[model samples]
Target chain A: MHTAGDVRVEDRDDPEIIEPTDAVIRLTATCVCGSDLWPYRGIEPADHTLMGHEYVGVVEEVGSEVRTVKAGDFVVGSFVISDNTCEICRSGYQSGCVHRAFVAGTIGTQAEKARIPYADGTLVATPGQPDEDLIPSLLAASDVLGTGWYGAVAAEAGPGKTVAVVGDGAVGLMAVLAAKQLGAERIIAMSRHPERQKLARYYGATDIIEERGDAGVAKIKELTGGLGAHSVVEAVGTRESTMQAIGATRPGGHMGFVGVNYDVHIPGFELFLAGIHMEGGPAPVRRFLPELIQLIWDRKIDPGKVFDLELPLEQAAEAYKAMDERRAIKALLRP
Target chain B: MHTAGDVRVEDRDDPEIIEPTDAVIRLTATCVCGSDLWPYRGIEPADHTLMGHEYVGVVEEVGSEVRTVKAGDFVVGSFVISDNTCEICRSGYQSGCVHRAFVAGTIGTQAEKARIPYADGTLVATPGQPDEDLIPSLLAASDVLGTGWYGAVAAEAGPGKTVAVVGDGAVGLMAVLAAKQLGAERIIAMSRHPERQKLARYYGATDIIEERGDAGVAKIKELTGGLGAHSVVEAVGTRESTMQAIGATRPGGHMGFVGVNYDVHIPGFELFLAGIHMEGGPAPVRRFLPELIQLIWDRKIDPGKVFDLELPLEQAAEAYKAMDERRAIKALLRP
Candidate 1:
């Protein structure tokens, strides 16, 4: 598939394993991310880029250095993977590794093949070749699901914490799911869409606040004893959404923002006086892929339910459009 | 005393106790602050403000609730006297208390007689009435000095740490002093001014870099083997200074900003990716006042040397002009 304004179903040359450390996989299932909507919205840098990142695939070839996998292994990998031994990777921030490489557009996961770099460190083999029924959920583990999990962890969401998730997009909704899985006692999901509200509730949101801005802050304060939530996940990157996340957190709280930030500016005075700890970038999805993949393999959670629409890999453009136009919570593309 | 474009010495009626919770203090000495120069620069609100907030004075009277000090005790008090038992105050953020009040304009320490409110919680008595010689050092502990100490503490500067200070103003210099006193192994003072460079070296700056922006970032990386410092103190609030402080810190480092941020903006993406813990606002100078006072009394450190000029209260305008024009690091006004 070639990426146009949306990804196209056009034929392209088949990918081949080019390096000793590389792996070629036949994508079993792949999905577009809310971040991909950025390019569709004309905010992100896009130039002949393949559109999707999340994928679960069957390995068709393996490099000699990749001793961990064989041709038929089913696997899920993080978007960016490293040796897991470099200084940055060792520090648990694999996203910033000296040799970091992205998996989606460069390798084109929303196609019949993907060339995964640093296979030993990035790809996690499932317990066995999964059934077709598990494909969507396993694909979720590849990016959206794992990204959200990292977002929750970055926000410090854990037992007894009250987490407020800003944005009703798939990542934000999945963050609600992740926070719930992390044992947060109260999850306040901010969303206006009725369908998303339903999904948010299903994902364990204890409350829903439709308001935004100052009014939203007031409502959150009212619900949270005027102290705001202990943790907030900002899955939308905009001045307004960033402020809402900051305003919804109490003093000494933490905000984990996974949104691809574009021109978002936080006022210095408010941030200084608010006293909240902030940490998040592009999710180190590689760090959490193994555990999340395990969770999905064991059937302990059903994250695949987030994919409301599925299209053949040939219709990748429609997949992007479905998610961008809000006609679908998430779109799964089958190759 | 009158405060104009410049500080002026003038006559006024002796301030009467405004409330039963107030005390009258006969100031021994008062000094200028970088913050005070803000209004004179036409950046801050000007209203013939009473001018000074830093002082070492003899208590001439006490409120009925003031059990900590008696009428003849020499004391140091916070810029804002807050009742320590309030919910917000007890949280160790007394400066943001519901009833917080500042002393500079309403009860000017730059005057002969200064009115102190919430005296019991605000004033800390010295070992005894200090000698005339130790007055300036003690007065410095009242604001700028104490603020620097708090900044260091907020930055978590301590043993085996490398601390980077992002401003070369009085507070920044004093922060170097505070960080050194707290046992930081390396202190990188970001300065190029000869006067500040001398003071920074004297106060234990292990290194100095004059570059700003990306060049400055490169210098810091070069200094730290590309890992950046463990702690950073931001004493200047502009976007550039804030970014410098944040950017100079390592992944898990802390950034303590005590600068009065006026209309400054920070990019969310950079901050999130940095993963630096940040804390600071109006310094809770009160929290550090007692310990800083004791350190001053013990003569362990003399932060007061930052005052580079002295003038009688009558030439307050000249003092303000001296500081505003950068002729002095700080000025002292003896009323």
Candidate 2:
């Protein structure tokens, strides 16, 4: 992003193995993320910023210390880089790893190649070269699929649970799939977009709530016999969306918030009175990578369906515009 | 409490069973709570309001439908009344019960006689009351002990975890005891008071930090290998205390905030970055009543040591003043 709203695709030096623990991969697929819009819409600063984080590729080169992936191996990497050996990473919070770094704005993956540090920890190789048709799903596993899976797991969505998702974005849609896969008894998708609503249903959303805010909370309670959902996932970081998610959760319920929060402020008194379990923040995508890759490889989940618009790497600007204008749930970029 | 800093003891009609499930109890013991200070200090409204929510007493009378406790039975009751049969109550959130009522503002237990509704759900009868030495311990179970236990449970404090208590008051001290009983490997108490520090240690706090706010958080991190505590209990209902508790918790750790929040606003960005599990509210004391009563009866835990000042019901004003001035950790009243 040269400047807010002016994303120009420019030629730059390719990423290289700068560290002994690093591995450079030739990009096969990359995509725009909901968070990318923060800088695009000028909500956050952007000046000559590297654009993408999500990526899937075949390893082209590995530093001497890299052992997990080798040249010619197809691999998927998390948006956040982690050593995965630190105490935090061992506790399944790889995003908060002591030696963690954001892949965005540093080693932008929306290019021919990118360098991934901590190769043994951040990158997970597929069983073998993935079939051509499975590329998109594998790419989805790089971030969205893993993030949504984390959100579901954090919300404790399982058998006998009524899970309510509080966004219509790609991440929210992915959470629906995760909840379904996790065996939730009911999945309520809060969305007004017809296309997203359709995808939500395809992902196993048992109910659709077009209403939002207080009305949305009331609807959830009405649907859940006046008790609200047992688990709620907040995939939108806005104040309204966050509060709505909290309000839609029953007492003693759990809420998993995965949206990148900006200026939201939660009133402690209301939260206390709501009496719900809340866990959120940056999703530790690396924690669920192995399992998500297996699920996608097994053809059990099609998270790539969230990408409604596909464009070549050169058309990255258009992909940003499409997502910013809400014309696409997510836009996949092919290099 | 009649206006701020004014507590008066006056004669009034003795409480009578008003509901079929109601039971009238002759108070044996009651106490001043930290929350009571909110009204006493005029932070919350209080005009000729009844006080005292914590109590242990003998059942004096029971309505036709009351079955759990009969007249002459010694019992401990929660600060919140619940029908117990409601879904919320059955789910162990009796404090958020569909038919819940506060025991503080109405049916003040500090009086000689008080009416308790939903007796079957709210009151736990002791095993043949006789030991006067165990009265105070049993009374603590009415609220503080149970609230602290719930806080510990909410924080998931158990073996191999380091638990931190963010207050030195009765509830905070009880949380220390609860964490110890739950098998937390380490318990850190944040307090500057020598007396409270001693009590915290006696209750099993393995470490003490006199620093507060950011300093206290830094000290906690220093003690836990720069990672902060695994489980944190916030028993002080202030913005600084709340943030301190959140800050003193490691990423992916759990924070149980049992403090009755008043104007606290939690920044979403900070909390999201903290990446921790947080659960709190009015504790479901009724849920832990049976076990706590059993513990007290068996002399396994002496939670009553929290009451450092004792007074007769006639000196309720002095008790409130002592607590307001921080001259007493807790004030126990013999009604």
Candidate 3:
């Protein structure tokens, strides 16, 4: 699956259990993430990076220590594997684990099979076997969807809170969906696209503001009694989005950001004077995987709608191009 | 007394009770603040600006609605003139009141008399007349000391937490003192001066890290199992100090900053990646004045000891010169 560009996908030997805590998963579905766009854009340090972190699959083999799921079980795993007992993971932040390692490093889901370390702690088992209908959504629960949900959680979105989502990308759109699930009374989607606006409203955005900068701030304030939104989820990684997130929040509100910030600068005085609580980074997908997987199994929500284009694993190049060209909200690669 | 410099002491009409809610205070002692130094140095707006905001004084008269203190009562007040009954003020953040006003807009404390508005809400009185010896320490509680104390509170400094303080100014020094009184298990003072180091120790600093940036981060990590402090107080308004405070904290930790941000730039990516909770702005000195006054009256702490020099109001220029020249940490002017 090598493209005319960099990063050739070559055939590799099937993954084996490297540790008693590891399990081997036969990939069924994996998708390209907006964060994955970082490397292709020349922002993230790509090098020989395997280039994918979201996946849903069937367990092919399990080591003795893997008790939560057995062979033939359907599952989804987080991007960064961690031992759940560590202080970092125990505190519900698995991405910052002391022994943290990204899935791309060893046998990523973009391939035929992958080895999941700390399998019991990092992977969530679906109820029995997941139907083909739920596969894509469960795969999304592995990273993007869960991350958007975590962003809403970090922003403290809930009833009576007005939430402003600062990006129209997949994650940002999903954040609107998450805020709605969290019972946000009013959701403002900051986007100009007709398609995104439609999706935003369908996902529970009560209002839409396409303005940028001071005008965008003014629009949000006009809709919020001039106090700004109670919560802001920033899903675009840039100085402007960061400032917009801060400026869109009220005096004692919160800003949750999960954008893969690649060289963004903020003015110190503005942040200091804004007085907003900020908390975000790589999302703790593992922390939400179990619940998300359960929700998907129960058919409670359909977050998989974010993937607008689907391609075979061999056509990964076309998938990336579709997303890179902005022709797709998100692209899926079926392995 | 107008000097050859920016600092001037002019004999103005004695402040009288103008509003039914106002009170007149005869200055017992008034001191310069680090923030006040900003205007004196022309870094902030100062032309026609009345000089001080911190003072411990004898109440000369009280308006009809003033019930908290009476004539001849020794009292301390916050820089914010807020009606305590407002929703914002009742939330313990008087500085953010809907109708908030600052002492700087009217008559300041570097005078023989000062007019205090919202007297019942802004002023806190001692049980009885204060001893002359307690005046200096009590006066410090008016702003610098209270601001620093609020910095610690905002940082959530309490039992079993390791706290780091960024800045060695009078406010920072008092923050070190505040953290100690708040029961922080470990206090790391980020200072390089021998004098400040000694004062920090006296204020209960358990350790000192003189290095800065990555090296300082490494030092803090080495001291806390490579996890950073649980709480950090930022009292310097520069970009470096703000970053240091954020960097010096562990994931899920908190940073409380009070330094009036000058020209500082913050990188949004780094802050987002750090995942620390931050909330700060002008300190609500009115909320803490009562307890601080009691502490002063009981002689448990000596925050006013931060003022290293004293001068008659006639020598206001020399006082400013001394502070601007770094010859004095803080200067007290006898009106």
Candidate 4:
């Protein structure tokens, strides 16, 4: 991003293996993220920030210490680079690793070639070069899918549990799929858009509620026999969305929020009297990559359906605009 | 509390068994809570509100349907009345039960006689009428001790866990005892007062930090090999204390707050990256009463050591003043 609402694509020097554990990937695919819009709309300050984090590509070069994948290997990497050996990494919070790096600005994937740090901990190698048909699905595992999965896990969405999705974006819809895969008995998708609502149903939503805020919470409670859902996935960071998510959770239930938070203040008194559990953060995609890759590889799930628009690398601005204008749930960029 | 900052001892009609599940108890002991200070200091609004909740006394009468404790039985009651049969109560969150009732204004325990609702669910029968020596301890089990235990439980405090207590008042001190009883390997008490610090040590605190806020968090991190404690008990509701508690918890660690929150607002972006589990609210004391009573009966733990002052019913006003002035950790009233 060159500036607010401005996107410019230009040729740059190709990345080279700089660290003993580094790998340079020739990008096959990359995409626009909801968070990218934050800087695009100038809600977040930036100066020509190199954007993009989600990626699926073929390894072009590897440092001497790299062992997991070599040249020609197909790989999917998490948005955050982490040294898996760190204590926080080993504790299932790799996203908060002491030596973590965001792929958004420093080593963005939108370029033709990008250097990936902590290759072994950040990249998931495919069995072999996957079919072109599987590219989008594998790419989804890079961030959005893992983030949704993390929300479900954080919310403890599983057997006999009723899960509620608080957003209808790609991540929120993916949460429905994650909850279903995790064995939730009921999945309520909150969406007002017909297309998104239809897609939510296709993703395994057992119920749909278009109401928002207090009414949305009331609907959730009414649907759950006045007890509310056992787990709620908050994929929207707005104040209304978070409040609804918290209100929809039953006492002793959990709320797993994954939207980049924006000025959310949890009223202490309400949370105290509610008796609920809450845990959230950037998803530790590295922790779930193996399982997600296996599932996508086995064709057990198709998370790539989230990408509703596709564009060449040169049309990156259109891709961002497509997502920004709600013309696409997600935009897939080909290099 | 007739109004903020004022305490009055007024005569009133005796409480009678009004519900089929009710029981009347003649109070042997009642006390002021740290939370009471909120309204006493005018931070919280009160209009001639009857103010005490903690109590231990002999059952004076029982309604026709009462079965858990009969007349002449020594009993300990939770501050919140819960119908144990409710799903929420059965789920161990009696404090959030649909049929729950706060005992502060309706049937305050500060009087010579008080009515206990949901007798079978809210009141735990003691092994037998205890000697005068056990009254104070049993009384503590009604709220502060239970609140501390809830904090420990919510924080998942257990064997091999390093737990940090963020206050030095009755609840915080009891958290040390609770964590010790729960098998915490290391219990760090945050307190500057020598008397409270000594008592904290007696309650199984393995370490004590006199510093507070950021410095206190730094000290905790230093003590825990730069990783912070595995679990944190937040017994102070101020923003600084809550922030300290959150800061002192390791990544993916748990923080259970039981402090009566007063306008505490947790920042979103920070918690979103910290990956900490936070759960707090009005404690479901009724859920712990039975086990706590059993532990007390077997002489396994003495939670009552929190009471440092004793006064007659006529000195109720003075008891409140003593506690308000920090002249006593707690005041046990003999009615």
Q: Can you tell me the CAPRI class of model 3?
A: medium
Model 4, residue pairs in steric clash: A272-B281
> How would you class the docking of model 2?
high
Candidate 4, superposed: residue stretches over 4 Å from native = none
Task: List the TM-score for candidate 1's chain B.
Answer: 0.95
Per-residue alpha-carbon lDDT of candidate 3 for residues B1-335, written as tens digits (9 for 90 to 100): 12123676676887778899999999888887777767766666666778778877889999998888999998888887778786557757677665577786476788888999888988888888877777778888988889899889989999999999999889999999999999999999998889989999999999998998778888998999987888899998877788888899887678888998867777767876776777777788988988988888889999977888999988877888888787888899898
TM-score for each predicted model, relative to the true structure = 0.89, 0.98, 0.90, 0.98
Give per-residue CA lDDT, model 3, range A69-134, as digits (tens): 889988889988877777767878787776678786454677778889988888888878777888
Q: For candidate 3, what TM-score does chain B get against the true chain B?
A: 0.95
For TM-score, candidate 1 versus 2, the one ahead is: 2
Provide the overall lDDT of each model, using Cα atoms, as 2-decimal numbers. Answer: 0.82, 0.93, 0.84, 0.91
> In terms of lDDT, which candidate is stronger, 3 or 4?
4
Could you tell me the lDDT of residue A182 within candidate 2?
A: 99
* DockQ score for model 4: 0.78
DockQ-wise, the better of 1 and 4 is: 4
- The better candidate by lDDT, 1 or 4, is 4
The fraction of correct interface contacts reproduced by each prediction comes to 0.48, 0.82, 0.52, 0.80
Tens digits of lDDT, candidate 1, B26-53: 9888877888877777677777677788
The residue-level lDDT of candidate 3 at A22 comes to 93
Clashing pairs in 2: none
Q: How do the residues B100-121 of candidate 4 rate in per-residue lDDT, one tens digit apiece?
A: 8899887888889999888998
Q: DockQ score of candidate 3?
A: 0.52
Candidate 1 chain A, run of 10 with poorest lDDT: A1-10
